[model samples]
Target: SLRINKGMHVDGNWPALGAAAAVAHSLGLTPAQTAQAVQIAACQLPMSLYLPVRSGDTSRNTYLGHSAQLGQSAALAVASGITSPGNAVREYAHVVLSKEPEPFDDTHGFHLLQAYVKPYAAVRHVHYGAWAACMLRPALDPDKIEHVILDVYEEAVIYCGNRAPQTPLQAQFSLSFGLAAMLGWGRLDPWVYREPQFQDAMLRALEAKVQVQVDASWTQQQMRGARLRIECSDGSRYEQEITAVPGDAQMPFTERELVDKFLGYCEASMPLDSARLWARQLLVAPTNTHPFPFWNLPQEKTPC
Candidate 1:
């Protein structure tokens, strides 16, 4: 009755339902119709696995993109009078997949407030170690570092245990490489997942030094934590243990920080002034008439 234990890809499994509900609501469907769309989406969802991720093949990346398409398709299907079983979600979960999906009462409020926005590009499991590595980076000399050890919760090891991962997506799921990226680049920016960083002498060297181990007690308690210990060639050791990463529900990023992150990304593709205007229009003004001001941003001219 445990889908995670059965190796379901949690990433793709959940987004489809959320997307379906979102689209259905945006289409001005009634509550009952939105429920129908979500139910239909759930019934058609795949029992995805981690094969592509494990093998460094990018095929699995399509699953989430397909999930978005599936969501829109399901909403459209409902609009076109496609009816789903009354208990399609529960039946498919308990009977077909032997899954016991968590029940949410939603009594108090929306769960969107509790959502986490990642400061780094890696999985949530990899963030703790990556953050710790970033902290120790300023103190350590990369060339003098002899080895690094990461003791993390059990599931972190299971889902993010890739050693010397060969591909960008594979590295995204790698605990060792994420930590190494932080140490080498002083931050685990999305760009570090590229082939050149993977081929970097310092990153490759540091990545090879990283050893991942399971902290059995933490796993038994189902705790999310990471402890990083770096052993230097000169016998100087640096260590840090983190119980929570930034941007988590308990330690959410401030509004200013979040806005800064948005500005940073937008500025990368456009002028700083344009990025500021876009942010102010979209986020500050709340103008419905000029929705998505990003479209009006400057575009480079095509070569004739």
Candidate 2:
């Protein structure tokens, strides 16, 4: 199967495309079947296209995850002899890409790998906000920070305009809340979007300090890029511009890092040793194995 953006392209859309192609190939589908699967996956999981277009949202972080799952499902459907309209991509182009009512991309060389990944979990537009928070942390005494003035791309303001969020989930999509979370917690994690922290007085105070603005020069082409200008209580100012968020393929995660993340996520639900062993075996398991032993391991419920 051809993976358009399997290698070095800055576009964030590549992950979904690559994932769909990978799933189709793994399921032993034909080229046409795989392409159809990819189109279906893209349509079913429009987060890549929609998430970025919208202001910062928590769902944006999981867009690729949705694509991956949908791709797997689409491939399975094809393997099960389910018929699709065969014009998945054409339909997508008509409904999604083109303003017109018809799909028109016949070009084979077009690839999606041009996409990038956010190093932090917050919205792609606010990576620099997080970075600015970190940079300002050392310069200003947290107790004395009176206010923060954030000057970012106009699109940033447009995307993350929700200033006051009543819930952590909402806060995850709010620029002010994200900057506040980063400042108070020093990191952005799944828990940062949980209850008490979302309601924390200190975090709320920090959130109150953050202000956003837009820059006319910042264009849609610069999706993951941001510029942060911070004004502090002590009359100190700090400014930084991030061209690309970390964890992009250019700044790829190491294999060990990937393994550690996988272990961290799965170890709590299963015995750590068992999980590790199962993972290791699965990594090297031969194709001839009809029933994978990993699936037969004791199943346990994990916290969602």
Candidate 3:
């Protein structure tokens, strides 16, 4: 019952929501009930609305969190004889895709596939900047990196280039900060999101090197494109251009890599063995199981 589009990145809590909905549907829950469960699941998800977006914040990020909880809630409501819009997902999809008028097509091919995932847990726009920063690392010593020129799609600058980041959370949304971390550390990882890293002198100097330029030809269809150029004090120059960031379906992570990432994020919170066991089960389980003991673990111990 757990149906997923091929080549999609099931990041954040999306996999959990999909599994819960499939299990509910398989247990004879009506479509309306299933829809209610999904809504409830989405409502319970944690929200991160502070991430900036072009012109204004789009509800895409917040909606996904809500959609997960909503799915669960819809499923439970149906099981308990509650009623909801029979075409819940259809309607919701219409809203997100900017469909006009009532009676939207359920088969209209909503382009959820266009959504991208973050390989580095930072703002989506910052991914290319991070990629660029990492590429320049070997050529330029952190102390010698004099400046960075970030040539990105116009939308990226507007959304991710706000005032200087004053908090770790804010830094995640800053192109300059992300690039600085990449230049100074030779990579961007969860550890780079810490307070000390955010306040480092070398990072600030690298941040000063960051600059943005708008690419007029870019379009929504070309969301993943970015270009970076770096200059070092010893007359060394490094540059890289990526049409699409890594972790997209075109450049998917290997199964082992994905599993490693999942486990790495969960091990500290959950029993490492249990998390590994459940992740294996999820990959090949014939049918979705009941709330396995694995699913009932304490919230702090749950695998992301």
Candidate 4:
């Protein structure tokens, strides 16, 4: 998604910081040193605006490579005691932003999330792109569909429509591909980007028929909306307009949902019981408790 939709390389920040901190911890750096290391790494961070999507190969590893390396480099630099945190961040910022020329795009996935998708995600259990996919599905007939037309605000068109998406990351950033994927598979799942599914003949046909246009009337900043119009081969027409998405400050994810997501991440590696135990300890543990019992949780033994 960072490849095309949003030019800002924010996805790299957390991983780089995490790597820096972990290295600092291993080196037994003082709090000040650790902070300085993180600062230095952040300053040295580079954004990869030029996506290799046009060249194919959209693996997660490829997208995260630069950020991950920079993060570890920061940690290593701090461990070596040669980097001055304050000056490093300042100088790096000047060098990256001022000394170099970079292309800037006005629309980004972050803005779409903050302004539109999150609200819908919070309310409908789907992001705006996914919601558009779902809403467009019923209008299309698997056997007789002619084309799909999506009319949305300018930023939506700018951020979501990618004509040449070669990788899953590019696919996710594409409004047309995402919607087509949802329609082709009846729903979008992480696995939808894998194997035969990525090369699914039916989805490619559907995606080829998607066209997105900007609605000139939605010129205001707060106008976050989209209209999906379908034209069938039988000369029939269907339209759906979404003026508001859910999950804004007005609508929120329930506490149970948050807990479910947290547990899902934990259970991906360990047993559910272990995840639950750790979660209980992490949530209820008193502030500044030493030894951090949650971190001491036993590793899962591999089944031979």
lDDT of 4 by residue, 98-178 (tens): 543233355645543454224211112224545665766766675677878877777665545566466776676677776
What does the lDDT read for residue 263 in candidate 1?
Answer: 72
lDDT of 2 at 226: 55
Decoy 1 TM-score against native: 0.85
TM-score of each: 0.85, 0.63, 0.64, 0.58
For candidate 3, write residues 46-140 as lDDT tens digits.
Answer: 33333333223444345555555545555656576765444444443344334533453367564576554567868778888788767657767
- Over 4 Å off in model 3, which ranges? 1-117, 220-222, 270-275, 285-304
- The model with the greatest lDDT is 1
Model 4 pairs whose backbones collide: 119-246, 119-247, 120-246, 160-175
Candidate 4 has a TM-score of 0.58
Question: Which candidate wins on TM-score?
Answer: 1
For all candidates, what are the clash counts?
A: 0, 12, 26, 4
The better candidate by TM-score, 2 or 4, is: 2
lDDT of 1 at 41: 88
Residue 287's lDDT in candidate 1: 55
lDDT of 2 by residue, 156-241 (tens): 66556667777554555577877877778777756676677768899888888876766556654545455666665678777677
RMSD (CA, angstroms), candidate 3: 7.9
TM-score of 3: 0.64
lDDT of 3: 0.64
Error of 1 at 157 (Å): 2.2
